[model samples]
Target: MPLYKEIILKDNAKLYLWKITEDIEYLKHAVKLNTNSQNRVDSMKSESHQKGFLAARMLLQHIGYTDFDLYYDTFGKPHLTDGKHISISHSHTFSAIAISNQSIGLDIEQVKEKILKIASRFMDVSHLENLSETEKRIKATVIWGIKESIFKIKNIEGISFRNHIFEEDFSLEDKKATATLKYENKEENFDILFDSAEDYIFVCAFEKQ
Candidate 1:
């Protein structure tokens, strides 16, 4: 699959998704990676991980950028050389990236029943009340992505999903929500956008200005 979807969340922010249908060999030859990225891919033990890594770069090329224009900071957050904010995520068969003029975070996760088992560990389980088993799983997955995306935006140390990140109550049909981060005596808010693709949930977070 080429580009699974392209979403213009805002005038300055966009999201790109790639469904990983091609083999590693096809992805390897589809995009040219820098030496560092090539070495990183070579060091990956899981073919799924390698394909996800490569698919991300493939998306960059589809958007007129490449691996060479991307770099990471000491905290392992990705940034573009041209000063655009970038976040990357991959789960199972899907890879995605969000680029924006403002700080942003992106995350994709496969919906699974296991999330319900540990939902209390990272989110407010009360939010799960009155839902069918399937809805609970999807909502839990989205809340998890909400916290993950916010963490990516902050990239700070000692932020616990259970304690520090909080998602406001929202229904599945809303497809968007807000979250708060209370860590180290600092309180910050973020705008959240999320949707499902197949069995996967992808979320985007933007630091509220």
Candidate 2:
């Protein structure tokens, strides 16, 4: 059980992260999945993806829930049968989920130079200035993670990371920030919490109440 980190947020909401160190075979046999999930996993084309999917089920079991308790709506957003809001994300070697009493979103991203290549695609480049190359990449990855979390919360079509979401100015030391989602003639705010582990950044977004 590589349950890497468990965070207890406000209002009984919780965040769970799993470091995927096991083989696909180990994860496949460790958790029970419904027919839909089984078929879904069987259809995965990549070993990395298959491992991430299985690791998610293991995370569910870590928190005493199973695949039977989870389902997706027509919009493709996952929901827990017990009515808890859930958002999930998987990076190269890490998977994360956030369960909350209110709308929530989570994302894990590997910090690498590739994000810097497309920084302007989803974030403001000025935000990267005055920082070392490594910090720039890490910060850019955090911004991408921020936007992804917000997108998971909204789940609305046509919300472009560049055109719709805006993350407030914050230094790395802050460890927290705020963002706004402007879409469909509506504007909503979200609170963001982020951290780095093993070169990966994990972020969680909670809709402003």
What is the C-alpha lDDT profile of model 1 across 76-97, one tens digit per residue?
A: 8899999999999999999999
How high is the CA lDDT of each candidate model? 0.95, 0.91
Best of the candidates, lDDT: 1
Score candidate 2 by lDDT: 0.91
Model 2: CA > 4 A from native: none
TM-scores, one per candidate: 0.98, 0.97
Which parts of model 1 have CA positions greater than 4 angstroms off? Answer: none
Residues 179-207 of candidate 2 have per-residue lDDT tens digits of 99988888999999998888999888888
Per-candidate clashes come to 0, 0
